[model samples]
Target: MRITGIRATPVAVPYRSPEVWAFGRRRGQVSVLIEVDTDDGVTGLGEAAAYPSADIVLAVLRGLEPLVLGEDPFAVERLVRRIELVGTWHHVKATSPAIAAVEMACWDILGKVCGQPLVNLFGGRFRERVECFYYVARAEPDDVAAEARLATKAGFGTCYLKVGSDDPRTDIERVAALRDGAGPDARLRIDANEAWSPGTAVRLIRELERFDLELMEQPVSGRNLDEMAYVRGRVGVPILANEASWTRYDQLAVIKAGAADVLSVDNQMDGGLANLKRAAGLCEAAGLPVVKHSLGELGVALAAAVHVIASTPNFRYANQAYGALLADDVTSGFGGGLESYADGCMEVPSGPGLGVALDPDRVARYAELYRTEGASFSFGDPQALARAHALPKL
Candidate 1:
């Protein structure tokens, strides 16, 4: 069917706690949800992690309209190619989420038209449920320990924590507390978000290895593969690449450089769900496992990724999700809080398309919240912004 129109909504969903990383902190998730309407009466849902910013994502969507309006929603590949090459969005990686949203909506339309779930269309269920890690927001050691205990009680196999605090000793203490609370069996993953230098990474990782880290994520900058390789060689902890592997091209370079033990992939950062699957295959061929990364997403985006992850085999690690942090969701019974997860896994929606529908009332609530105070949910940390903190914090 031909595309009719597209509608975009910006929403801000509060987090149970602020998401802290090396560079900044966000109090909640700000996402742009798009609905693509078809002339034949089929509508598809897509969500973009307002990465960089919502204004940019909305502008990208507006720019993509002429290229998308009359196209066949089923021809996702063609549509995506047109948007990338002809629409000249290939160079601007920041605009990827918006393009991915449109492409995702098309896939949703395709699944609905075929009367099949996206997992089946992608390759059938290699797995019925996708496992996600509990994200323990960066906090005091005691708080981290408490959150870790809660994660373990909830049956999560893995717990993810952010490291790379200004003081190296503080990060070490927090990790120790996490291990103490999460116990011996829980896999603990830490992300530095490209905050450490190679030397610092090696030294810190050597010290932190006592906690039995599942992996150290982007401990050093992702820009230099040699730096990553150097740290990986010196450290006992396996490295999981994040910023280094945003696109399939970057994944290739990371593989060739022998920079990481695992690669992180994100459809929102790339172009679409299909591209995410492509990234997995690229890494799988290199004998590397893939973990799905998030820029903070809601249920609609989460479901879309789940279908692809469920259908793929090499998603051998617990993927990232905001379930542990999101206070509530705009969708029905999916991806809001820790309650939505059973044993740290979300069951793949068995319905057609993305298999999850929006809750209009909840959407309205969050949309209003975005309208009233969207800035509070942004990536900028006011305190961090006020202080002049240099990177690698040496």
Candidate 2:
């Protein structure tokens, strides 16, 4: 069937608490929910994390509409290529979420038409369920420990903590508290978000090795492979590249440089589900494990990732999800909170398409929330903006 129209809705869902990292804080997730209508009466669903900003995503969607109108809904690769080379969005990484949304919707349509789930279409379930890490927001030592305890109690195998505070000692205290509360078996992973210098990363990673970190994510700048290789060589903890590997091209560079033990992949950042799978394949060929990265997504986007992760094997680590942080979701019976994830794993959807549908009531509720208080959900923190902050906080 040919595409008829594309409808977009921006929604804001609150977080249980603000997500604090080195750069800034966000109170919740803002996503652009897209519905692609076909001439044959089949509609497809997609979601784009409001990465960078909701306005930018909206603008990208508008720009992409002309390119995708009247095209076949099943021709995802061709459509994405048109949007990339023809629409000239290939160079702009920030526009990827919008392109990814359209691509995801097309996959949904293809799945529904073929009477199969996206997972089955994308390589047929190498795993029944996908594991996700519990996001331990940056907080005071006591609060951090409390969250870690909550994560461990919930049967989560991995606990992800954000490091790279202004004060290195404060990060250390929080890590220690998490270790103390999470006990010995919990897998502790830390993300520096490119905050530490190479020397500082070596020093701090050496100190934090007592906690037994599962991964050290982007401790140094991603742009400098030499620095990443340097830090990875020195640190005992395995390094998982984030900022260094947003796309397959970036992943190739990271692999060639021997910069990281693992690489982080994001459909939202690179383009779409196809590209995400391509990324996993690229890494797998290099014998490097890949973890799914989240810009901050709700159920629709989460479900899409779950399908691909379930179908792929080298996604051998607990991938990122916002369930531990989000208070509610627009979809029914899927990821939004910790309750939806049993034992820190999200079961792949079994129905046709993405296998989850949006609850209209909840969508309306959150859409209204977006219209009224969308600014508060953004990445820009007034407090953070007021202060003088610089990266590589050495």
Candidate 3:
């Protein structure tokens, strides 16, 4: 059926605790929910992490709406290509969230039309459930150790520690505590969030080599491929590419440069499932494993990631910052409870489509927040607003 209309609503859901990363603290999660309506009376829902503003949503609608308004929603590839024609050569970080929203919605529509779950549509499940890792913020060594124990007790197989705050000694102590707390069986991973330089990463990795970390993620800045390769060569542990690599094109460069051992794919940042699949395929061809990057997403995208991980044969590592940790998920916030993870594995949603339904009442509540104080359309001062507006839509 043809797409009849596209609508976007931004929402702000406050977090139980401030989400602290290397970047900054997020008091609330801001996202844009996209609804795609088709002629056959079928509607698809998608959400994207709304940053700085809802401009990405506006850009996607302004660019893709005209081309998709009268076209078949099933022609997702053609729609993506048309949008790409107007999109920048390199993936524009600002518009990726919007693209992710639309792409996810389109996948939803396809699943409904096929009368199958998105996972089945991809191929078939290699595994019925996926293992998950806990995302712990940068905190004191004692606090981090406590959190790690909680995650392991909660049935998570892995715990991801956020590093790169200040004081290398403190970071090292935190990692050591987590490792000690997790003991010998549980997997521990560290994410520097591009906080360290090559020298610092080398020094830290050397110091923490005794802990047996599963991997180190984005230890250095993503921009310098050569430096990343250099770090990879010098370090003993497996270095994962998170922000440093995204699409297949980016992975190709990383592989050619021999930059990283693992590729962390985020559906939100990597243009949704289509590009994620491509990147996974590339990683498989290159003998590299795939891991999912967390973006504080809700059930819809989480389901999509489960489908990808289940269908993709090359994915090895469990994704971090997922499942029960997210406080304001539309699905679980309502009545749709998350699948329980037992002994380090979470069962995929068995229902049709993305396997979750949105609570309209909850959506309305958050939508009002977006329209009021939570709406952020520009990042800089007053002058930047005009410049942002002048940028081509999509």
Candidate 4:
């Protein structure tokens, strides 16, 4: 089918718990919704958690539309080579979120065309549902502990916490509270978001070892794989790289350096669903588990992730997509919210495409919000997002 038209609508989705994560101090998410329409009337949908800002995402998408129109949606490789946004847009770098949305829409159209779910393209389904973790954003120790309790109460297999602060001891207290409140059975993991120096990362990892964390994610900068490996060697916890590896080159660098025990994958950041699986395959060859990451994604993006995660073979760790944390979602065909874990696992969508459809009314509302309200996030200063009360050294 020939692509007839491509449309992008900007939206600023509000977060239910905006005050939690330091990276998301702003009260809302600014994203662009993408729709690709073909000559046969088959339409595809995708979500872009646009980086820098939604306006930039819209601008890039508009600029790239002319290149994709009248092209074959199924011809992904040819289409990718045609526009060639690599060095110019940083392919998997600065403009990934924008590139990702358009790419996801192409995959959606391909799935609809083939009359099969995207998971079928990956050699059929491995499992009906994938395990997911309950995400507890960074907050005070008591608040973190309370969220952990809620996660366990919902029968969550894991509780993922965002751990990184100006003070290492504060993170320790947060972990201690999470461990104590979540009980012995619930697994706990922390992501520093590259907030610590290599030396500080090692010291903090060593201190939190007693908590029996499942892993410490991206403790230091991803730019220095050697430093990451050094920290990995010194700590008992498994290290998973998030921001450290976005492209194939980055993943290869991490694998070659043995910087991490687990590799984190994001569909949008890694060039959509197909590329995400490629990254997963590379990690599997190296005997590493692939973990799905969430960064303020909406329902559409979460559905895209589920499709890839369901088809990925070497993914062992649970995924944490904070789609449910958003007050508004474009769709809800994923069965339950992010916290809704049935027996500590989430059911995959068996439907076509990403297994979800865009909610026209909700989409319209947010699209209108984007046009009128601009971006709703405060993303204020990272330090400003932290709690004023500080804990003493343990």
The TM-scores, one per candidate, come to 0.99, 0.99, 0.89, 0.92
Per-residue lDDT tens digits for candidate 3, residues 303-388, read 77787788888788887544545556566432112234566665677777777788788889878876786733222233323333
Q: Report the poorest 10 consecutive residues by lDDT, candidate 3.
A: 385-394
lDDT of each: 0.94, 0.94, 0.75, 0.77
* Higher-scoring candidate on lDDT, 1 or 4: 1
Model 2 per-residue lDDT at 358 = 95
Where model 4 places Cα greater than 4 Å from the true spot, the runs are: 19-24, 85-92, 335-341, 382-394
Q: Is candidate 2 or candidate 4 better by TM-score?
A: 2
Runs with alpha carbons beyond 4 Å of true place in candidate 1: none
Residue 236 shift from truth in candidate 1, angstroms = 0.9
Model 4 residue 226 distance off true place after TM-score fit, in angstroms: 1.2
The TM-score of candidate 1 is 0.99
| Residue 340 Cα positional deviation in candidate 4, in Å, after optimal superposition | 5.2
Clashing residue pairs in candidate 4 are 26-378, 26-379
Number of clashes in model 4? Answer: 2
Q: What does candidate 1's lDDT look like per residue over 145-246, in tens digits?
A: 999999999999999999988789999999999999999999999999888888889999999999999999999888999999999889889999999999
**Candidate 4 structure quality by residue, lDDT tens digits, 26-69:** 66667788899999899988888867677677787877777788
lDDT of 2 by residue, 212-236 (tens): 9999999999999999999989879
